[model samples]
Target: MSELRFEDVTVRYGTGRRAMKAVDGVSLTVPTGQVVGLVGESGSGKSTLARAAVGLAPIAAGRVLLDGRDVRHRPARGSGRAVQMVFQDPYACLDPRMSVGDSVAEAIPRTGTAARRAEVTRLFGLVGLDAAHISSRPSELSGGQCQRVALARALAARPQIVVADEITSALDVSVQGTVLNLVRDLQQQTRLGMLFISHNLAVVRYVSDIIAVMYLGRIVECGPAHEVLTDPQHPYTRELLAAAPHRDGYAANSAHEESGAVLDTEPPDPHHLPAGCRFHPRCPVGPLALPARTDCLSLDPAVGAVGRRHATACHFAAPLPTPSHQAT
Candidate 1:
């Protein structure tokens, strides 16, 4: 069975006149012992979905299943121990006054004093922290160390799955690598399931077994990490990858330099979303002209079948005629 599953889940905020569905008819299955990357721009409902999966956000419709049981109906309180969250900001997550040891130990309560002490020491070691750092406060540690402490706290409950929401975005590049490696190592050691949410497609490619792309509260594409990254079928997916910073040098007359290309349009406000595909407004290439692209703004764009290990929500899933930005 999948570790966690969202069956046609919908989370609507507000009521009556202003009710808005942050996650609209979204369904996903995260298998055990694998990392699933949820990639999208801000306000794409990634974090909202993450919160609902972990019981932090309430679901307005559909079932949030854990091992095939509805968590919303059953209220998986103790079962939450098996599914924990490592938030994006570690410093804000931790208490300034509490000792790092106390914070980590708070996840799992132990009976005997000796056993508790040993558990704390083991967890510290597990997250690559010095045992001596246990007594220190949050202010005493660097951003990376604090994040490690956060990971240790999440694992303290012996969770089978962790929802990591951009955990490395706040850290420096050097420190981000350490934290990413640590999470990967810890996952290998524990064989834990993970739902990793991020905007960075490069980082998503590195760690995800599967990638799910989101646009305006809907999953626009889903596929294997390498396949989706290397050859994206959706226009939004292709645009995202093209815009991503790469290691390779760009030629003078490149896709990025096209004058009329819609690379700089602002994302639509989530409260007042546009019609048709949420990404249509910002989509660089379309069959017709902008603003009133009748064919492009058709009711139901053709989303390819969930075969070939890739599914894309585009009326035209055809390959791009012109080359996208060069691969770094």
Candidate 2:
């Protein structure tokens, strides 16, 4: 088991004035045997952070560490790579011409031919795929099956950390649950440190022990799964929970009604981000609230503790009012 730590990690694209910061000074930890869910809307830099872990995205500052060693410039090689990623689109990741078993076999460290075949068979079972599909191509399998092959390929690498970037977003609604369950079961069995990225709060909550909310390339809130879900502190987080689909008996209608005005507009341009709080333009409790907090325009709030194992990056961080609170 190994832990993956991001120490003030920053990722940027392009150069000079045109450079856009995709992931800003973010510090997150994915301890062994636990899942850290990274949740945010599209373009919030959730995927960029995932890519950085596996050397797909370039890091401009800070370090990505595995077991206390910096892997920023030179990622671990072979089995030592430790971190493997499962991308959002399974079809895109797997080669169209290759057999599914061969695709998975490519990721395995060099071994005897018989051993490699046995390993592929074992991985197929591990991901709940039938051994019969070993010779199937990506086009021959359904969306859910393709994702299973993707998971199996990642497992073939024998990684200690798995970064799953919206793995289920591409599947049908009914199939998503099955894949999520497989992931949770696999994590328990292997105890692999995982960074699961998604835009859906409900999905993240179902699979994660810890959850971190991102906005405009910065982690705006982070805490234990239950605490963050039932009592979101940051306005952006609250808005996200409010907008989450009311399924699985979870509903944040009160928060939705209170903060619906915030998300009506799009987030500010990342290339030319606003000064101070990047979320100020769409923050309900900042620029849009009654009396309008002026400090949000000039002072960037750093992430700070709001509860045990809970932190939010907002000067006005507070629990979103519930129906009971409103009555009082």
Candidate 3:
């Protein structure tokens, strides 16, 4: 069963005509004992959806289901401890004044002094932090260490699902792999479900069993990580994979970053998203379509399955025999 699910969820910012939907009609599930990776560029609403699950973001429409219950009815004030989040900034989320031991101990249900201490010590070892560092403050620990502490605190509650929003984005490349390995091993041991969000495709592809691609608040493609990365159907997915680092593929994203997007226009205003396929305006081939690109410009495309465990939302989406220009 899906431990966490979003059913046509939409998160809006502002009110009246000024309101804009940051996450629109997003339906996803994080089942038990699996990692679902979400990949998108900045302004793509990846974080918004992640926040909605934990009652941090208001759901403008639709429902967020946590452990088979609607979050709105659950009243996150009490019965909402089933899900925990590890944010992008490891240091910011932590309390500077509180000692790391106390921070983790706070999550333990046991009120006895000795019980809390023992649990904290065990948690420290689980996250690879030393028992000696229990009294350390946030300022005393390194970035990676602080992150491990944050993770320890999250796990102390034994939440069923963990929402990790770019948790490693701020760490050094050397530390990033270590953190990833630690998380993967922990997930296996605990059978914890995860919603991993990041702009880094390499990390996502490695850790995620399934991957979903987002653009401008809409999911454009989703499937098994390896299939989606190596044989993309949607144009945007192809671009994202082509730019993925360490893959034996051409660096198309680098060119896009240096010069400009494939489409030679200003970034679309999120406040006033264009009608039709949200990705069409930026799609290189959509403009040249027959029928005056009416469907491409006016009708939103529904996600259609093209192969096993794969789907794409594009009027022109067609899987290539080999989408990536990788060295054979």
Tens-digit lDDT string for candidate 2 (1-328): 8999999999999888998999999999998889999999999999999998998898899889998977554534555357889999999999999999999999998789999999999999999999999999999999999999999999898888999999999999999999999999999999999999999998998999999999989998998888788777777887788778757655543543453366678889889999878888887666766446887888877634343235678876664334455555
Q: Alpha carbon lDDT of residue 136, candidate 2?
A: 95
Candidate RMSDs in order? 5.9, 4.9, 5.7
Error of 2 at 140 (Å): 1.0
CA lDDT for candidate 1: 0.78
Window of ten residues with lowest summed lDDT in model 1: 250-259
Per-model TM-score versus the true fold: 0.87, 0.91, 0.87
Clashing pairs in 2: none
Task: Please report the candidate that would top TM-score against the real structure.
Answer: 2
Cα-based RMSD of candidate 1:
5.9
Residue pairs clashing, model 1: 247-328, 248-328, 302-315
lDDT tens digits by residue: candidate 3, 159-218: 878899999999999999999998888888778899999988878887898899998888
lDDT of 2 at 156: 92
List the global CA lDDT of all models: 0.78, 0.86, 0.81
So what's the TM-score on candidate 3? 0.87
User: What's each prediction's clash count?
Assistant: 3, 0, 0
Candidate 3 RMSD to the correct structure: 5.7
